[model samples]
Target chain A: MILTVTPNPALDLTWHVEALSPGATHRVPTAAARAGGKGLNVARVLHGAGHEVLALATTGGATGAEFTAELAASGVPHRLLAVRAPTRRSAAIVDDRRGETVVLNELGGPLAAEESTALHDSAVQLARDAGVVAICGSLPPGFGAEHLGELVAAIAASGVPVVADTSGPALLAAARAGAHVVKPNREELEQATGRAEPLAGARALLDLGAHLIVVSLGTEGLLVVGRSGAPVHARLPEPLHGNATGAGDAAVAAIAAALATGVDLAADTDAAARARLDLARRATAWSASAVLMPLAGELSPRHAELEAAVVATPIHEESR
Target chain B: MILTVTPNPALDLTWHVEALSPGATHRVPTAAARAGGKGLNVARVLHGAGHEVLALATTGGATGAEFTAELAASGVPHRLLAVRAPTRRSAAIVDDRRGETVVLNELGGPLAAEESTALHDSAVQLARDAGVVAICGSLPPGFGAEHLGELVAAIAASGVPVVADTSGPALLAAARAGAHVVKPNREELEQATGRAEPLAGARALLDLGAHLIVVSLGTEGLLVVGRSGAPVHARLPEPLHGNATGAGDAAVAAIAAALATGVDLAADTDAAARARLDLARRATAWSASAVLMPLAGELSPRHAELEAAVVATPIHEESR
Candidate 1:
């Protein structure tokens, strides 16, 4: 079983607008709400891929209750550590005409010290029971990188492989605490490595005691670096376009699933990379299908066809 | 006492971002959540002016509860009709660099028949006890213009003057029901009267059985029409830069306050118009002041200054 921990979760509200004119009023044609958090999205994608996954997160107030209800409705198993303040909401305004998307995120309120302890306790318990644990997303206010780093250390102490997916200081702290895998996108990788090249960034993270490093390159594909072996590259054939809101989470989900199922580390990295590419393609198709249907549960056959085309390729040193 | 009714109020969430590039992720620097709805805004402005005001609106679900809590925190006197379904939320992403405000509003779910009846019953009770009642804002989903029209008629039947502020079919329906006053902006006026001229539009509503008509001309001023008078034009000095969101509501609030204080109809129109401009100016000042001091009380001084500048001017002839 794969366990995912989201420190700060949100109810993502998306509004579809024709064209966005600044300072001008535009009526929204459609709106949708989904339970969102990096870890929650990872768990959702894992579950969608027929994996056993449990989502653990800290939630509070009315929005928290709504988030829990939405997760239940989506059939995603989750345990919420209730706090005093409300969980923040994130907004995504999709301007279809210009193909632009603007995201507005709230800096969630601080959590109590007791709540932080409770979250750590929950993560420990879940990590002990699961084969792989992924801690993802931004830490809420009042939770410093050191605090999150401690949680990552505690999970690693349980002998479960830990995947830490986050950015900024938290990512730095988690790497110092020795996470098994750290997934950072290209920009984040640059910040982590202080280098523009993917190889240099991946090497920097691995040097920080991360056993493996996966750097997401958006449309460019994924870069993998390991301690014992030379770096491997997994390339996708097509560039996928869509919201890309949950694409990183999908990639983490694939990695967690592959690791738990005993796929070889290099093979798993390749598989995870391809899975992300495929998911991106599928996501784009699903989004297009939604334009025509505007409702869930009505994906076009093209979505499945795109998913089928994703092939995991392992690049060994000899091949390189 | 002046009463304001908002059948479907919302928690207006505004996210201020540097620049919004749609389809790209952005981190918001500032976020604010306030109780919103046309009637609620009117009530807030009235309360700010030290008027005896009671805000009545529906509250339901978690968001509604939060909305009510926020109102309480802000010291706004309100009576919310609790409903089963959650109240809706609207997100506005303001890009200060581009001066664009993109709004995504939820299609607020409809109230049940019983809920609708309860709202009407509450409005009737409030109207019976109040000197003036204003029914404002767009009707929530599942409610037709006729429902609002009937509600206005019910309030008017209580012998208290009823002011209906709305647009589109709802305005026509309310006017046909013989509302004491109808306020429509230029666009709404054009839609209602099929004329671009404010005078023509105000006169059309008067012919449709409205006893008094207030046509808001945004920056120019207001055009007031009554049975005994030809038309009254009230002008306002151009306000400094500010968000004009609640300006119209502030105008309604001022009108109700002036009318309750026994001001003549023409005088009331001019007072309201000037008050609106003042409100716009102060609201802008407050927004800027809020950046330095995040205290709600800090806005009081500006509010008072704006109130002092509110001058009512009567117009004997309409400006071409």
Candidate 2:
């Protein structure tokens, strides 16, 4: 079982219109609402892939109630801790005429201290039997970078591997907590490590005691660095053009799925190294497949074929 | 006290963005949500004017719960009859760059029959003590035109004046019920009566048993016709260029305000005729003042000055 934590989740609403003219009235032909935020997306994808996952988050107010209802309707297992403030809503207006989707994200940085603690406690309890704990997305209001670090340290103490997918100071905090794995996109890694080079930045995370780091490079693929001082790169043969909104989260989902199925990512043996490499290949394939879908937290049906098509290679310690 | 009934109420949301490009992400700098629908708007405006008003509607689900909460926060007295479905949301994305406001209205015509009946029953009961009863906006799903007419007649049975602001079948039904006052914009009046001329259409409504018919002509002013064969036209001397979204609702609010204060619109005496003309003048002034503001259910502070500047003339039957 995998436990996913989304501290600041939202009810994502998408509306479809024929056209958008500012200051004019438009009739929405279609609309959809779903649970959103980094960890929830990962949880959704992982659950969809036949993995047992529980999503934990703090929710309150009307938006929070709607979020809970939607999560229930999705049949996605989740536990919502009641808070005082209302959860946020993210609206995406899909204008098919221009092949554009305009998104409006409400700033959700007001999570109180007590609320954060409540959410953290619930998450830790849910992580007890979980094979992997994936801590994802933004910190709520008053939940600073240091708090994220403390959270990571506490979750990692449960003996369950923790995968931190976040950015900025929070990413650095997770690394310092010895999170089993830290996933950061290129920009996020650079922000955390102050290193322009992806490999160097990932190494920076490794130096902070992280057992593994997957630096997402968008269409360029991923740079996966392991605790044993080895690096593997994986990518599809060709770049696919589609909505890549949740690709990074899908990658985290794949990692959690691998961990749940007994893939030994931390083992230094030859068989373990080979398994870790294969995990990277599969994760990269799942991410690539996700890019072909229109909705986030969902995947394209071609994941199996994409997984078989991923090419991976090992990088020597001193590639220079 | 005035009782306003909005069968198909909604949570109106407005978002301000620098610019809108279809298919792109936009971060809203500001957003506002208000309880909306024709009768609610009238109720809000009347309340703002220091008049006691109660808004009654069917509400349920998360959105409906939020609607009730926002209404409570606004300090407007309201009765929310619980239904099995959620209320709808109407979003307006204001793009200042293009000087445009794009609106997206959800399809909101799927309410259950039992819910509609429940709302109507509560509204009729509340009307007993109300100085004036106003039935406004579209009839919700399963709430037909005949139902609105019956509602108006039932409310009128309490001897309280009933003001109906609606269109097409609802407008015609209200007229047929001998509603104390029926307000319809030019287009709606024409649509209901199948008459190209506003005056002719308004007269047709009077023949249907409406004691008074007000045809809103936007900046051109208002045409007030009574069953006794009198027509009074009132308008601001000059047109104001601004948002006129809820001007009609504002007019209805003014009429309800007049009735709540004991102004008679159906008396056959000369003093009553004079009072009815004054009501028309005040309502037109309120409508004109509303056109200068951005939000609906809100009045400009310059309403008094606008009211004094209204030009009105009573037309004899021969002149028509």
Candidate 3:
């Protein structure tokens, strides 16, 4: 089974408003709550693609219980290590009229030292038997870049490949620790290298011990960079709109799954890129259908298409 | 004893951000959650003033459990009627620099038929034993205007005066049921009477069987109207610059406490008005201090002074 670790998961609460006028009262038209975090999103999309995925994370208090319940309802298997503080809730107020979204993200609760050690131990134990272990998202308060680096080293020692998707100091640490795959968006690459040009930054990340680097460019497509091969480019079929919340996670899920299942690095890169574009298309369609149907039922068709598309792509990369 | 009922209480979550720009990600500087609702606020404030107050409301699920825990932690006596659906949460993003607030309010979960009946029964029992009972805030989705009318009538039958603080159709129903007191802000009064002049609309409400009508005019203060008496006017000592989220509830709290303790009604009217102003002042100070300190530890020293000032003012109608 593929294992995914989300260090700081969240309960994402979304409220729909007609328009957001500052300092003015708004009556919400609708509201929804879902389990969220980059790793959790990857697990969910992978589950939709018919993969046996286990999600591991540290959870706390009432919000954590709610998050677990939502994950269970979504049919994604999860193991939660209980903690003392409540899990953070991130709020998104979507104004459909002008397509504006405002996110109010809470600084996640602090984790105890023992809890952090327990999480690293769990990751090591799970990585021992897993094909590929994906560690993603932000570190909770109290756990720093070195903590993530230690976890990457632990998993790497277990002889299993690890895929790391994060930003800032944590991403820098993961690259330095020799993560097999690193997926960072264009801005993240620029920030990581302090370079305006993403091509150079992607190569820089690969040189920093990342076996492969995938740089996502919002609607344009993705760029794949490796140490000994020419970079391959994959362009999405169509321009998409709506929330860009989970698009990167979808890409990570596809890449990790393909790599674990013996797909060649370059071919898997192309498949993963296509999978994200497909997910984006589905996510937009799902949001539109949510207007006329319950949101829960609107995305199944698109999810099925994404699942099928990822499976059809050949595993071996062919020279262009 | 004074009783306050919140049919749809919430766990109020406020995210403090330096600035909120739409279609962009923001990192909140701080986040706080508290038990909140009109009646709950009234009960808490009254309890702080050394009054015997009972808080009654519907609660369910994990959020409800947390709400109850918070109330207990604050030393407020409460009786929560369990409902089938989880209580909703109201989130606000406060922009400190611009003094702007964005509210995303959720429609609270609907009450089952048994839960509604149980709430009415609880209200009747509390009304029979308490000196004054205040029914506060909006009805949850499952309740109609007639539910407020029925609740008012039941409380009135016990010879305990009912104070209704609400707006729209619920205000109309409460008025028709002959509530002892009804407080409506200027805009709500306009909506109820379809008249731009709030005083005229307030008088019309008084004629509809409401024994007393108080119209809140934002920072200008309050206007009290009754049958066979000249309208009484009370203004704040100073203009308030903060958002008036719970000023109306504070007024209800002061009125209920004064009436229960046998303070003169006229005197209490002025006292209630002043207390409302005081609550506004304290709330502002508390919010600003909360930006720097823990919210519970941020109660302003001015609170006691404001309370004492309100107690000193006895309401006396000039024409009465």
TM-score of 1: 0.86
Cα RMSD to native, each candidate? 4.8, 5.0, 5.5
lDDT of 1 by residue, A212-265 (tens): 777766666566666654455554467554455665666677568656865445
Residue-by-residue lDDT tens digits, candidate 2, A176-240: 99898899999889988999999899889989988888888888889888878478999888987
lDDT of 1 at A25: 65
Give one digit per residue, the lDDT tens place, for model 2 in B17-58.
Answer: 777776555655335778887888899899999998999887
lDDT string, candidate 1, B161-195, tens digits: 77888989999988988887788888999997898
Better of 1 and 3 by DockQ: 3
**Top model by lDDT, which number?**
2
Q: In candidate 3, which residue pairs get closer than 3 Å at backbone N, Cα or C atoms, i.e. clash?
A: B266-B315, B267-B314, B267-B315
Query: CAPRI band of model 3?
Result: medium
User: Model 3 chain A — which ten-residue stretch has the worst lDDT?
Assistant: A289-298
Name the candidate that leads on DockQ: 3
Candidate 1: give the clashing pairs.
A22-B100, A23-B100, A23-B101, A100-B22, A100-B23, A101-B22, A101-B23
Residue B233 displacement (Å), model 1: 4.2
* Cα error, candidate 2, residue A62 (Å): 3.5
TM per candidate comes to 0.86, 0.79, 0.85
